[model samples]
Target: MNVRKFIAATARDALRKVRETLGPDAIILSNRGIPGGVEIMAVAARDMELIVSPRDSVRPPGGTDAPAGGAAPELTRGADRAATRPAEATLRKPASSWRPDAEVPLPAATARPLTDAPPGGEGTSAAAGAAVVPAAVMDEIRSLRRIVEQQLAGFAWGEVARSEPVKTEILRQMLGAGFSPRFARELLAELPRELDAAQALAWVRGRAERGMLTIDGESDIVDQGGIYALVGPTGVGKTTTAAKLAARCVLRHGARKLALVTTDGYRIGAHEQLRIYGRILGVPVLLARDAKDLRATLHDLRHTHMVLIDTMGMSQRDRMVGEQVAMFRDSDVRTLLLLAATGRGDTLDDVVRAYSGLGLAGCILTKVDEAASLAASLDVVIRHELRLYYVSNGQRVPEDLHLPNRPYLLHRAFKDLPESSPHRLAGVEPGLMMAGGGEGMLSVGGQRG
Candidate 1:
């Protein structure tokens, strides 16, 4: 690759030089400070691409200036032009003592063959056998790129914190309330920059509230009357939520129209628990061990106005989750994933991803009363765009289950932790948390209104 070394009194100046010369498409190979200024090694993006994937540089055995078939003509022209140009040449010097006095030329491209010719000489086979970049080299390049990107990101986030204190504060508050950094950052990306702290907070709240998908009265499952399955990870209160839905259905359409089914034969007494709920509500409880049994049971209960299935609750990592999803999907049962409000943010994300194969009809928030904060649950819901159907806060079959209260939920989600709370994020902790995980931190200069 034709790498060039540029030096200036500051990184910004050095980068400007790179951009001016390389058309803003230069790939920074290395950047560091020198004795009196900053030094950067960079290559034109097009040149780097040729080296990165050398097939475009490979020529036919006839020795003509033709690239292998399927290579871009522009790239071929550039490769030819590069062959005649003198690469950057500079004396190697210790960065600690080096000074920017003269231009340093890159090494000749011919010295480093883009692709190695096979023993039979440069032939069609040689063109086909293009050089493969070493895994170690690629890994090192990625590591270097990531380090540069993170450094730039940290600097940019620091700038945001300085210039947009309200955004930074609200981000801290969101993290303290257990909202994922990805969601919080995304929601705040559109906040008008002119808004004050209170206005910004209000805007963020309004945005979050609007993003949340909730079930309306007309779309309530009990009123609509169809087969629905409550599915989620173990200990998320799926069985209890199922009973609550059953009771609601019974009250709305009478006991004859509601039937309870359990696919949780794995847990001892699991069926018995659903059967108890059924008996108390004067509803019939049936067991369906597998897909076949589930199909037959659904066929038998076709006349019922509503059938609520309590599925086996396994760990999201359990392979059987896929099977359960397939069973419900094949039976045409709409699934409502039961997510515990108290679960950790990462755990909730995992559950949603695991059960989201064939797609969920919606989701139900469980253990709302037990959670210290509803931000995590609501965050996942809004991000995954899952429709919130019901909120289960207590053990009471019907009394505790109610339609989603959007206002209350939104209020609870943005509720800050107590000042004395140890879990509350303060100072730079929030910024670090948002920037720590590499998964979803927006890049520097990313879209943020």
Candidate 2:
């Protein structure tokens, strides 16, 4: 028997070389892909008799063939072919020179004929023919498992130890309000590590405790009586929030002191929506087409104590953002940018930037009830240093709007008392405690507790 090695750019080329050099009867031993190309091993025999009738004839001690039908040939010629072959070689050689050996060891647990057995076997075969797996393969598998376990353990510990207190508080609030825990967890994990684990957790808890509709900025201010415009992007509930604030003013002052103005002629029922709210509240509703018309309307309603202007919902991409800004210019009306809590950070920034030319008084956050997290909104508010005035939750007027008191807002936003745990009220003050609270009661009096 003779063994040879061949290498080629591809597996096909290497196999072709073996077949050409050793004839079509050459047995392939092994083949593997290396950096430069494929490597293959092949075996061939020189004697034609050894290649033919391999299973039936055996080579005696002097290389003479045994007589036919005599107690089976002892050293089957074909057995040598199987013995010389490697396990990794998938292709089989021609049966012309192959034969079964009388003393060939059978597979340990085969129920079928040995002919159906896989190429690699226990006896009368090369060590490679058994296809024994290398130790490195097992090592690689174990290494991968360890790496995965390390990653999971790190994540779990960070979540429970470092991130648990704050995340737990925030998650409790969100879950209490019917949010999916899986989604809440995913969002929390994806939050950028801008704040430390403690601060991030605290921020999340604050958002949950504050409720979706609660505002986080200054709300108490002397009403400088004049026309005030509420402007924001499309679908942020500006009209509804306007009605809420107007209702609050009317309840505090009187219906006679308030008037409603709308500049949303783009949508069919936009004007009617505000008009219906005005009618229910017993306030006058006026429409302004442009800056000149807005000026005229302001003059017409000069006697009104507070004029609330509800503008149309315009896309940030709309060309009309500039037009709207121009209309609000040089007017006594103070503009409040209404931001939706669910809006992306970049979109929020764009809205604020586009409307900055209008001399914004501050920002009013709407649809707080619909947001999963308020970090993006809070970041915008704090980064721009814009005062937050009101937060609106529902469509109900005078009920959903709240004045922003930082400490109170923060306390509510961060409040999460575990029901099963003992109330840890060690440092709490009497004024900070709620009227009917026990454990986890937070009291805010315009200062940190």
Candidate 3:
């Protein structure tokens, strides 16, 4: 393989040289800082094809293929016995023809991290001579790429801070509020790029609110009564949210119009808890253990104006989640995934993904009163396009479940963290976070699959 080396003062310049010399499809093998500048070793994309296919053994830069007798003379030298072994035959290269410049120490990227033998151990010399690249080398290349990207991100961030201080501050605030890196970056990417900090922040709020899908009073679930189920991961307040919705339904259309059902046979006091709430509002509570039971219960309550099924709380990773979803699949049931406002962004994302298959009618934000920031919850809701049905801030059944207050949620989402708080990112950390987002940072839409 023809592996060419390029040295330049900066990573950008070295990359440009690689692209110009080897075309855009060039594969970067390794790169690192040297005494004068950075050194990058790369090979043509086409050349990499030869390395993987053992039949097309690695050929020297300007030499013919080795004779059928065996590898070239230099490969069988006394000091490099490993190269002569049949095990290393496919990767055998004439040692005399290929050698990196001696100006610097060996490149760390060439070493194999996964092999039983350590990177610089006995077999490394033979492994290096073998042209087939190991997975570890690719990982090293990716690590270097990330480092370069981070450096570039730091530079880009500095430029933005100097030229667009308001935009920079808004980004910092969004990240501090618990919004995902990609979400915050996408929103900021579309900002007018000319507003002051206050104006920019307002713009961000407006954009976020517009992206949010919320139900108004006219389309309120209670007013449009139907058989709805509250589903979600364990301890996200599914039973509590169900009771809140039940109370709201009772108040609007009367207790006779509302019925509560519990599928939580696993939890100790699950049925009794919903039963207590049912008694308070003069609503009857029913229990359904499985899909067939749920269908029968729904059939029996066909005349009831509204039926609220409080499902069993299970981990999002549990296989029963699919069973629960399947139970409501063929029925007229529309699911409302209960999301806890206090959950982490990734955890909330997982919950949304796990329950999204229910053809979610919408979602209810539970435990809002306890969340430090609503940014993470709002992030998942907006990205998944889940209709925001209600917000349950407190345990109070009828009073706590209220229509989503868009302005208040937005305010809470973008609210900055205290400067003294350890959770708050400071200095160049925001830039690093955004940079690490990679291709996601460049994407305009914030939605994720």
Give the number of the best model, judged by TM-score. Answer: 3
Q: Which stretches of model 2 miss by more than 4 angstroms?
A: 1-224, 408-449
Candidate 1 ranges with C-alpha deviation above 4 Å: 1-154, 437-449
lDDT for each residue of candidate 3 in 71-111, tens digit (9 for 90 to 100): 32223231122211211211122111122222222334334
Taking every candidate in turn, the Cα RMSD to the unseen true structure, in Å, is 9.7, 22.5, 10.1
**Residue 37, model 1: Cα distance from true site in angstroms:** 15
Prediction 1 global C-alpha lDDT? 0.72
**Model 1 lDDT tens row, 151-199:** 4334445555656777778888898998887787688777777889889
Q: Order of all candidates by TM-score, from best down to worst?
A: 3, 1, 2
lDDT, candidate 2, 1-449, per-residue tens: 46799988654466678777886656554555567766777666343333344432233334443345332232343333433332112234211112222223333322224444224333313222222222343343334333322332222222233323444344444434333333345435534445665677666555444433333333343255667899988888888888887887788788898999999877888899889989988998988888888899999898888989999888887899999988888787899899887777668889889898898888887777787555556556655667788766667777887775555444443344455634322211111222112111111111111
Q: What's the number of clashes in each of the models? A: 5, 7, 0
* Cα deviation of 273, candidate 3, in Å: 0.9
Instruction: Assess candidate 3 and give its lDDT.
Output: 0.72
Error of 1 at 44 (Å): 17
Residue pair clashes in candidate 3: none
